[model samples]
Target: MTEANSTPSVSLKLLVLVAILVVFAVVIVLLIFFLCLRGSRSWKRRKLAVKHSSGSIPLVSKEIMVVKTSDLTPATTSEIGDVEGDPKKEADVKVDIGAVTAGKSEVSGGGAHRSEVSVEDPNIGWGRWYSMSEVELATRGFAEGNVIGEGGYGVVYRGILQDGSVVAVKNLLNNKGQAEKEFKVEVEAIGKVRHKNLVRLVGYCAEGARRMLVYEYVDNGNLEQWLHGDVGPVSPLTWDIRMRIATGTAKGLAYLHEGLEPKVVHRDIKSSNILLDKNWNAKVSDFGLAKLLGSEKTHVTTRVMGTFGYVAPEYASSGMLNERSDVYSFGVLLMEIITGRSPIDYSRPPGEMNLVDWFKAMVASRRSEELVDPLIEIPPSPRSLKRVLLICLRCIDLDVVKRPKMGQIVHMLETDDFPFRSELRTVREKDPVSSHADVSIKVPYPPPKHAETVEKSRWR
Candidate 1:
């Protein structure tokens, strides 16, 4: 009887164990089922995103709200910075340092195009442009200290006013093809658009031989300065900062494409044209070659104008200009930021002359480690870096239609935790080698929306 009773107890324990095991199996199966369902939903959302991105004005998450720096209230205006240089002429300038407080004591009144037309001379009428003397004082003053930087465009200088305000003065020189057109384009286009990423056009001195655009002074300097090592040592630009700059530039470009009343296509998109704020935020500059594309029009019928390596393949082969052309250029910029090399030049690895061609092979083979800059070999995890590379693939797509919209591009960089992934750590390429702050803030534009949002071409 005792033996039989013991046997019964053992069987009862066994049955209980079996029941627990069965419950565990069912729970695991249910978990997997829900995971698969979640994955399917995500896939469907991505497909919908691609589908809805087909419109001229893409299906955006936020409604854009634009504010001119000149339009900032007096209380807000007290925060901008004053650039260095001459007094009398620079005083007329009102630089817009975007949202970052420039810390300048004063910014001039009226928007870039908001000023009233005036007639100063007896011979010329109200529409007549100013004379060289008045223009000189307005732009390049006789002072020797007014110079800022020089390039293919000519000399740039820092000009100050009697009021302690500062401005960047670009002295125009007649060098080559259609000088007047370049001048007119700056005056006309700067005459229209206004965005934080875009360099502010406080005033222009367009009187005869003295033509120059007075702009807001950028503290951190050009994107090329940091990316190309102009600021010394081949320091790796942290992946986060690079993504931030890329996102900012894309925002500015998107604004030109869809947000503006009459859409504008920045004919030129190069690293040299991108200017950085103190925080290393990239802003797209150099609108001299910008073309206005209207909603009703299919293409911009204009001259075949652009820098050599950065122009789009389609736009170069044919004169047809569109927003996608800028996308292609942005791809080149993306490649530069990734590899930390100039777009042009034959000094890369055996099969990699330009970044676009080389990046293609790497992305296809799933060998991201091969594509990153040599300076930053040990980069952040493959996931975060890979996401950046994937975005580059979209930006540099051979077919313009394949490229992601700038707004969508912004979403991917800002919202996605792509720069980080499972078991990923910092590598040289993705992390800054310098002692400076490797991390950066997201700095989202206030009231993120559709109307006034874009990637800033902040290289200028």
Candidate 2:
């Protein structure tokens, strides 16, 4: 009986030792897990601090963020590389596109869901990435029937989205060396600007050697087509419609020149780049050649890229571009609108081939009436028309400093009391071939009762 009791005691001691070992093992595992958890928390805190550091990144809306290629999934990275060419090069290209700060809330089944869409980089705002398949489907596989326009930049197609929204898709050519750079420049330039008179960039698709830009579709065609298209002589654009186009276009340029933090100079401001909406509201388009002027800088020196006849003399000669350069182009457009003639017409007589030269000759000879378009059914008030002509002359002046600012031009167009009227009249009278002996030309129309109304109705 004593031996049996001793055996039970030994067995109890063994059981106690085994239980102790198991407890020790469990404690070690818990300690390791806790240490790992603490390390992970510290790492995450460091990352957050870096991301939120001041001045390192520009502040974007909470919902929108810049995306970096390195942060993208492997599949996305490969796709982007294919569309944009060298992935490293594309990443190096800095585009400051805007992103939405908040995502749309959706209800699925019986639950409310909020989806988080984020970009990889936070310095530049977000640019929506469109898959190739989506683009193709929207464009009907880029069918020939969908083609709207084509030029050196690329072919533009009318695309209908799944949401039934219409968009203009520009498929850039692949072989041009500057295509990628132009794409980035256009995306960044138009992305930052929001104006009723400026075309809006909807999204972009870059997939393996294919680069396409999506833009909000304007119902009516571009100004070039209306002005010079094969449409017969009985064009629908009346004088009032033409004036509206000019004023709207001027407002757009003014905004680009003065409204933004850094002024944008649209290097190409020809009729071809001005698109019209259903209401004949004009919006500036194709910012591929646009240049931004910083607050401290007056001009940027770059290679001149614009149409032959519409290019500013100063810009074309010296390769120096500024707001004044665009003013010159607008002056040409103004002349085109008044006379219903292209800036250059090879079919015209040699002396009249260039519209600017013809205009100067006509103005010098006091035959300004000859410049009016015969197609105009209801001409503007004589005084108003004279003011517009004088403004155009001032804008296209040989001396860049003499050109009026876009804002000033807008004011002059709305009001008959142009600040430079006396100076322009004096210059006209001093011409050796002046037709009239008297220098006094009275203002035909009385000034508007409410001068401020001009500003409010037109510019504001």
Question: Which candidate comes out best when scored by TM-score?
Answer: 2
Clashes of 1: 52
Runs of candidate 2 with Cα error greater than 4 angstroms are 1-127, 419-460
Instruction: Show pairs that collide, candidate 2.
Output: 63-101, 66-121, 67-120, 67-121, 68-120, 68-121, 82-208, 82-209, 83-207, 83-208
lDDT digits (tens) for residues 329-419 of candidate 2: 9999999988889987999998788787788677766677778887677777766677777777778877788788999888878775655
> Against the unseen true structure, what C-alpha lDDT does each candidate score?
0.58, 0.69
lDDT for each residue of candidate 1 in 140-256, tens digit (9 for 90 to 100): 444566665777677787766434567677776666433344555554455445788888765554432335566777877787878776544445467777778888898888887
Model 2, position 211, has a per-residue lDDT of 64
- Worst-scoring 10-residue span by lDDT in model 1: 436-445
Clashes of each: 52, 10
